[model samples]
Target: MDRLIEAIEDKQNPSVVGLDPTPALVPVQVMDAYHIEADEYVEDDDDNLAATGAAAAYFEYNRAIIDAVADIVPAVKPQIAMYEALGPAGVDCYTMTCQYAREQGLYVIGDVKRGDIGSTAAAYAKHLSGFDGADVWHEDAITINPYLGSDGIEPFTAAAGETDRDLFILVRTSNPSSAQIQELELADGARVYEHVADLVEQWGADTIGRFGYARTGAVVGATHPEEGAALRARMPHTFFLVPGYGAQGGTAQSVAGMFDRDGSGAIVNSSRGIIGAWRDDPRYSETLEAQTALDLVAANARAAAEDMRDQLRVALA
Candidate 1:
């Protein structure tokens, strides 16, 4: 948590770029360029060739974005599901992306959202701890699911302490359907998320860093401005990993209150809005060469990240 906070302070940007890529988000030209390599390596395995090629393309797309925004943003969050969809090849791509982001001096947050109990939870904690002393996953932090209770979360907290990493527990999410569970009213009149917020604060109580935030942070959606504001006040010690900006309709103003009075305490995330910015550029053409399209992708991503940073500065101001 201290490391992440310091990185954020150094950049003067309380924002993170989400490195979530999909076939639709990546340029077809770039995808086509990797087919030959995939075909050569995955020969005779018709079932795996397409997925392998797509995964390769996704990595290149991610690398372009990371190289573009590594200096402007403090962190890069690669949602695992995007890579996991491509099967084993995609998982490898996900780890490679994390390693690359870390190499570029950016904090890598694995948006894994893993949850379980006991030893199973311990296995998931390996994302932070690594295997046999080797940093396999290369994540500085990860998102966790807390529905399974303390047993599901304690292992991660322990691993974070041992590895000097951090975790953000899902409390209030950005998706529309999140309300179906997160907003449920308990008998005590507090919504489920509020209770989760309280627990999150407690979970990190023993692990507060130099910035007065816990190693265990909370995932609060940027879409619910009022709720986000209230959560800021309610969970003073819990830092926030806020999603739903840009493509998800979360404006800077909508998320401003999630920050502390000093403009700290939260890091907002933008995925498609940054990585997929090339799609909205009129100059981008499908007929362009693969490297040319990638160059365009990098330029658009950098511009979008810069714009997002400026918007946050103004909103916080």
Candidate 2:
């Protein structure tokens, strides 16, 4: 977490691009370049050409975007669900993407959101912690589901402690239906997410890093500014991973309070808005060849990230 914050401070940018790619979002050239052919992938359960092609395409696309934006942004978040849906081929792509990003000097946060209990929790923590054999998907930080409470989160904390990694426990997710659980009130009148926020502070206390913030952080949706501001005051020591910007309708103005008075302690994520920028960029030329088309996408991603960084600065001011 300290390292992540340092990266943010060094770049003076609190934005992270989410490398969550869908088939439609990736370029056709990428799919054609690395896709596992239909005949080569044998499992009917996971062997669809589209799925495999999408994974390969995403990896190629991720590499291009990372190449373009790595210098300005501090990190890249790869939502695991996007890769897991495609099966082993997708998993391989995810691993490859992480490795490539790390090589490019960018932090990788695996949005696994795994939750369980006891040994099960331990196993989930172990896997998500990047202990799987021949690991290539090692992450500098990860997101975990906090619904199962302390039992499910303790293993991850313990794992992080040993690995010197960081964890962002989901407190208030971005989806509209998240209120069903996160907004519930206890007998004490505290909202469910508030209680979770308090626990997150406690969990992160022992791991307080050099920046006066903890390695354990919270995922607070940027869509709810009042609650986000409230959480900001409540968990001063816990960093935040703010999502729901751009495509999710979260504005920089709404997320401003997620940061501290100095404009530190949080990172706003923009996925499709950054990766899919080529769709709207006037610089894109349909007449270009495959490699040039990929370069245009890369340039578009870089431009979008720079634009978001400036917007965030304005909102913070």
lDDT of each: 0.95, 0.86
Q: Which lDDT tens digits does candidate 1 get at residues 192-297? A: 9999999999889999998899899999999899999999999999999999999889999999999999999999999999999999999999999999999999
Query: For model 1, how big is the CA root-mean-square deviation?
Result: 0.8
Name the weakest run of 10 consecutive residues (lDDT summed) in model 1.
41-50
TM-scores vs. true structure, each candidate: 0.99, 0.93
lDDT of 2 by residue, 93-142 (tens): 88788889988888888888888876788987765455545454568888
Candidate 1 global TM-score: 0.99
Range of the 10 consecutive residues with the lowest summed lDDT in candidate 2: 127-136
Clashes per candidate, residues 3 or more apart or on different chains: 0, 0
